[model samples]
Target chain A: MLRSESEAELAFRREVRGWFERELPAELRDLTFRPLPDMVMPWYRKLSRQGWIAPHWPRAFGGMDASPVEQVILMEEAARIGAPEIPTQGLNQIGPILQRFGSDAQKEFHLPRILNGDAIWCQGYSEPGAGSDLASLRTAGSVEGDDVVVTGHKIWTTWGHHADWMYALVRTNKDVPKREGISFILIDMKSSGVLRRPIRTLADEFEFCEVFLDKVRVPRANIVGELNRGWTVATALLSQERLILGSPGNALRAYERLRRLARALGTRLSDSDKLMIAKARIELETLIASFLDAAEGFRDGRPVDSSYLKILSTETTQFILDAAQTVSGAYAGVKFPMDVDGTTIDFSELFLQSRRLSIYGGSNEIQRDLIARNVLAMPRGRA
Target chain B: MSEIAGDQMLISDNVRRLFDASRALPRARAAAACWPDTDRTVLREFIEMGWLSLLLPEDDGGMGASAIDFVALIESLGDLLLPEPVGPMLATVSLLAACQSPAADRLLKAALGDERIVLAATEADRSLQGDTNHIVFDAHWADVVVFATGETEQFSLRAVAKIDVDGLDALVRNIDGGSLCSVRLDGSMGEELASGARARDIFMRCRNMQRLAAAASLLGLVRKSLQDAIDYVKLRRQFGVAVGSFQALQHRAATLHVACQSARALLYEAARTVGTANEAVACAAAKVKAADTAMAVVKESVQFHGAIGFSDEADVALFFRRAVALTAAYGTAEACHRTCFAG
Candidate 1:
């Protein structure tokens, strides 16, 4: 919006802004906590019906085919309205992967359901022993007759308990290297031997869980790509997912909360508080610019080190929430949402929830290691 | 990429080659202990190449480039640690050209030729928000200083020749080995360029442009320091291994590298908003982010170099000095935050 956007873009922004303001329900406007699926799905389906869901997808795949700027506009508007966070494993990750690598039959079955919110998908990549080092995942898939029997444990599966399906990486070739032996498969969450147990987060929410798959049998045709090539298939669209993760939308929301908290307290911010807030604001602006930089690089076929973007974006969001915690003063330790005038402000909920930003997707430590090795070409230490 | 971006890259490449061949750092070091003076050979080459007139109107013997292009040029200069006061000089002339006054025209001509007419500020022009603090940058090299005075919406531009100024302090050596001077201009022998709202509007525009240029330069400084540190860590061994191979140093370097890139992206994006309505906030944000990033990079870069980085002989030390001055130039990070949040 600051860069002298085109007339059409401005008009488009105005349109999106108006639609969000008018259509978003009052109950959903600015929740301090993550709304459960039952409370948020209607809104999600509304967006799907409005043809705004999966803005990054192609129109041929039941998506809006949004341009990058249009996609940014959509995100900005959603953040403007404080839209509820929806399950996005289907939209951000698997939808694109399936578009690229799924069989025609799989596309015909899953794409429409994903768009219409009939299906909720959770990624099944990280196992008990393979969080950051995902290549070492030991989820076994032994083909027996027409079925591939899957068995293993997957941790940190977001929305796994409520998901209708799980896209997974399973070891199909035991003798090969860890990464090379894997295969990508989709499984029904309701299938026998598949069990989900929600793990409580530090934020005190059941946002993610661990799933135990014990000899779950799935049709061999459920495989997305070639056997022993799940590593390639899973990583094919990671840069795009990282790009979405690296957007400044979350940081903007966090900064808005910080500003609101400062205003609600009705006290003069000390010099140090002001300085921290300013630093956060400045970092948010830089994150916005870097998102554009990487997106532009992506469009130009230039090498966009999405790892750097992910680190900057996620860490900046964390930094802002940290600032908010500082500004919260005596309210910093408050456990529940406090009514500051007409608004309910949770001083610690966001501060606690944001801790996951640096830990999930890929830990910031892993991201830093990747950047050091790939971008800087630093030597691998002889272990 | 568009043709303009292609042209920018070409311009950046040429500028890099020029600085690379000119032994810029050595010359800067040689002039550090001397009175405020830049290499005339390098300055003359720069002027002859029309860099000083980059922001002037095409009708005024210049290319009429946008602030984005100006940022491109300044960033390259900063990366090589060029000793000349080219950035300030360019900003000074750009302001003059925008004024469209006879006095401004005369000063612009002198600046584009050989004289160094750097931008200055007095206490009266609060619009710049405590940028100068009564201390003028590159004052030792200035043949004249152009300042804006009067109230916020009623500013007036004035030019004072360095020789006629009274109560001007002797050139103080800066951390970057540049020259700064405390001046008390009592309005003696000063020529007014314009008055009232016209001057105020032009002055604000010039300030935004200058902020963008400084931010771009600070980002350049950060990139150089970060790259140098990265290179050093790979070559320097510790515990019978390259220091860069250590997770601690690698993570630290990676973090700094991200900061450098993020600030740079902000700088370039902010440069594009120069003439837009959002220019003020965008420029302020860019300046604050770049300044903070530069400080972080320079500090960590010194650590990466170990004790050798603290020595005067190390170019990283010079970069630290330059970052310190430049970060304070347009506005300190605190002052800029006040301006941004207040707006």
Candidate 2:
């Protein structure tokens, strides 16, 4: 666990572990495997069926209303076993956004679908021209009757090909400033003129895509918050997004892999090698404290300081991955795990995949800027 | 913020008042005048205000105090870049207060009375068998230096000889830049407070307290430097607009604040649980993070403050120097990381 658990938390952990042992098929819990939709969704739906999908959601909206501790425990246990990562676009962001800003009709339509795993969502925020400067998005959505005709390209859309729909920022007014012209519109991926070209990442997985929208008409009711004010609505979940993206679970998984591999290798290592591993472990443990604080901060509506967590998680994971690669020695470039006796370990992907940790979730540089300006209230430089 | 005791707040306010009254501008103007040395008047005021007795326990006839009671006071002392060996002095006092020795009692009481000084000393390198510590802090100021000898086996209060400071950091130099002396000790002399494991235990507590205060102080220096940079970036224009208006600089400054806050949270958390497993990890983490932050913020602040920042006249440079010295004093990031990992 990332934090110390109360008796109840400990009991909950056991329950989760037991349920996972029974319900989470051993085949699905493979640490070496990445869970794609078919292999992943059933488990997600199981959690959803139990009303445990949205831990932070209110009971009124399909959530069990699990406390922050419970939510964190769920993440820790799931990540602990390398249970497939659920499609979090709906679970973490859109569901919460819709819950907060969605019209009653919108919430009634989408929130249930999201909880039930009947609908999958991808973010349409980052485009080739507008990654860190997301508000400068040029994707235009023009009003035509009761439909908004959106035409633009969105890149870095994680799971865009797998998603059934997307909630995106499109410029609804060109004459206004870059940010003010934007509107948050939900578009069906199967709509006319919608196209998805999958992007293969460094880890050799097609987990992301470029979502192409050409005159795709979305219903007017799908506009979240208000038109031209999508910036506010979209950014409403920035803290939540940061907290999720900055979690220590991923690092913990990586660290566990490193330790496991070290033990299996049976290689006699020098003191420094052991020290580096120790350093990463210490950092991972220290980061969990901050992570727990951030989680509670988000849940309790306290000022969450998650930018540091983002930096810490990524850097520490990379540190561990670096050690793993070193321990892998001559086999660092191998695509598949080289077998010793029976232990299979593919640190190549771990090393490659860890690279994007800092690049995504708004590059570490951008997070630093956010920390410097928003949190510190330091003066901005010349625009 | 709520953790501040009412008395602590008053103590901090009083310390700030005293520091401001002894404004170091004319003094800092002297260039070479730095820490471990004090402004006589300010030192006298601290003496009169009973600030000297803060580390002594009431059982020893003082306020039964600890850094937790007056951590704010320590932090504010850091903010002003006070030119006294107050930090190590207080830490040394606390060390003696915890040690069970008749000499410790007399030494601590005299230290509190401002009669005889008991400055903390650096440990002899782990390999050395006999007594030899060439890098003791404020060794020249102490009537008797409290030192850990021979890899934590011996906690000794020894009479010391002051050797002049050799290498120095570039504003407010480390602990009154003057009066820092290397000392030689006859291993046979001084009172043995504790030996072996018990000695190491006290050493950890004292070392951690020193580290916690040093990191907190560096954070204060960073906060002040960041503010100074903020002020400069606003007033000092580059091209047609104020440089402070640039998002690039703002973000960097914001990141420093994050580091400061993170370090602070860890510092206080570690402080609260001094003898726990959490304290060891927290102390090392806080030290590493805070030290790195202080360095980054200070160096970048020079650039943010521009041409003037490079000159000796810029008070921010003083902060930069103090940061450089402080970062290495209690422990460097590398050392702290080692402690964190190897603990």
Candidate 3:
């Protein structure tokens, strides 16, 4: 029976901790408690340059190929040291999916650019009509000999304006099942017909964009997996995306901010608050164990199940955020008049950001349905 | 960053297999018995497997395993509903280990086989504080009797008559309210092993270990009950639909599963912290969460089974009763909160 971490693993953890303490930017640490201007990408590029972009990615793809346990340690240390949240649509979502299902030439072209931080990716997944019912997408991608003619409207495209490339699921066969006829296609956002319009959110920030694809031409080689079978590839990508969405850093960071705010507000730590804190602590611990179980399952060559992670992570994040808002009370709605360095804290932004968490990367309702149908093997509800 | 040594996994695997094999034993019937006793053969098997010696130092002819190892063992034991004083015995061993008394080594060796020792920590008043009215069970079966005095500063060991609580039932009815009483002794008894804050620390450490072990056991019970309910609902049909096919029941089962997983993690984490100074607070939290979760899950298991679950003959009811009884053991939820607030 394995007892504790081996001496070698402990040493490895120490080294990683040391490097994080010495090398992680101070601004990243400050941003953990207060949001920084969205120009933190340069620091992200630094980490990517250091070959720490995807700690679990295979070495052949310019990754460290760290063990699952090692990756956990890295994540824990990174969270502890308040590493900047790398805008990771490419590293977390597209990179992994492409690695798994992309063609040889596609990998050869994009993997290096992704490693060098030369190419940024955004997801063109949800649409006006197909937010939750993503498979019912009306986005069209018709074969045009050497190029695929794509004409569609994509909404809630996160970081769309900054992205160099866009990955989308488009309807390729109109007569087939909604899920079966979709194709996962990659498109250059710089294409002449691609238009991006930013959308303002409750946070009073334009963090997402709506992209209109007017006869955008995507090469045939840009298709991930096969035509009309993109649902499987998309589903797999969504599974990994769900895991990324469920990471604990955001919740932990929010929790720390909540504690600081509570202290600042001079609120006595009530028994209810203490119990809530304890519950949050225990919830995090449980999530860590379940995360380890999923990681170990993957490492041991078993198919990783994301249902448990999805349910717990999403719900727990919302629960923590709700608790924070309750604890912060009136101050939670204080709006920052300007981009002050540290004087004015905007709790309202956190409140608004939290609302998007349960909605994005597949809504919590859809996650619950997926958990019921896939993990629990529950029969579908009657129409 | 730490790689786990393979020994822990090996021990866990062995214990898991042992637990799985023992689950085939007639649990519903045995658990229904007023004083369901563990088979002597199984006890011997556990001893031979070095499970009982998991916490004892290797110099004392034991494995010198950490507290987490014992937790795994306790979890396995609880999963099978194994009726043994494993918690009490491990408590005694932990106390002895902490004290480092010369007698601890000799006594631990004797405790490896037929020797049975139960800690007499409970009092009639149900206060967590130690009492002088220590009740040693079956002295003939025990080579030593470790007792703590009310002063919280002294522990006196004596050769005394073990009270015969055989007809009184092996499984105490009110675990929360029960008292352990042997014939009273006057003056400073036989031998003084350790005293003062040192002794009190050792005693409290033992109590915390027992609490954590019991919590882990309850976690196993919760797991078993939830799994049983799930399996039952999947097979048993109602209104031309499998009971599990109903969203209402499935939701209930999933909720219970979440609670069980939460409680399980708390128990394991608490167990990992046992014997340290933080053990009291951690153990209190673990016991409260695990006991409450176990009780609710087992009760739901019974309710979910319908009339068949209500009968004493049914295994669901058996688990329900055990969960109820165990919840009050070690300490009540309120008492745990008090302990947590004590610091």
lDDT of 2 by residue, B1-343 (tens): 2245676777777877876736754454453643445445676677678777676667756676555564555766666776566777777777777777776667766766666666665544331222453455544355566666565444434432222222211112243253344444545656566667776777777777777778778877787888788778878776778787787777667666655665565555456556565666666666666787789888989999878899888987788877877776765566677676555
Model 2 alpha-carbon miss at residue A97, Å:
1.1
Model 3, B68-182: lDDT tens digits are 7777667765755555556667777667666666665555556565465534343222433244333333222243456666464444432222342332222223322222334
lDDT of model 3, residue A378? 62
lDDT of 2 by residue, A2-38 (tens): 2346789889889988887778887776445457778
Of the true interface contacts, each candidate retains a share of: 0.74, 0.39, 0.11
Q: Between candidates 1 and 3, which one is better according to TM-score? A: 1
Across A225-289, the per-residue lDDT of candidate 1 in tens digits comes to 98888889977757667888987778877887887776776657787777777777778878888
iRMS, candidate 2, in Å: value is 3.7
Q: Which regions of candidate 1 deviate over 4 angstroms?
A: B1-22, B115-118, B122-133, B186-189
lDDT of each: 0.80, 0.72, 0.67
**Order of all candidates by lDDT, from best down to worst?**
1, 2, 3
Q: Please give, for residues A22-112, the per-residue lDDT of candidate 3 as tens digits.
A: 8777766735322322556676677787777778778989998886667667776776676766667888888999899999998999988
User: TM-score of chain A for candidate 1?
Assistant: 0.96
For each candidate, what's the DockQ?
0.66, 0.28, 0.21
TM-score of chain A of each: 0.96, 0.94, 0.89
Residue clash pairs of candidate 3: A1-B7, A1-B8, A1-B9, A1-B10, A1-B11, A2-B8, A2-B9, B153-B196
Candidate with the larger lDDT of 2 and 3: 2
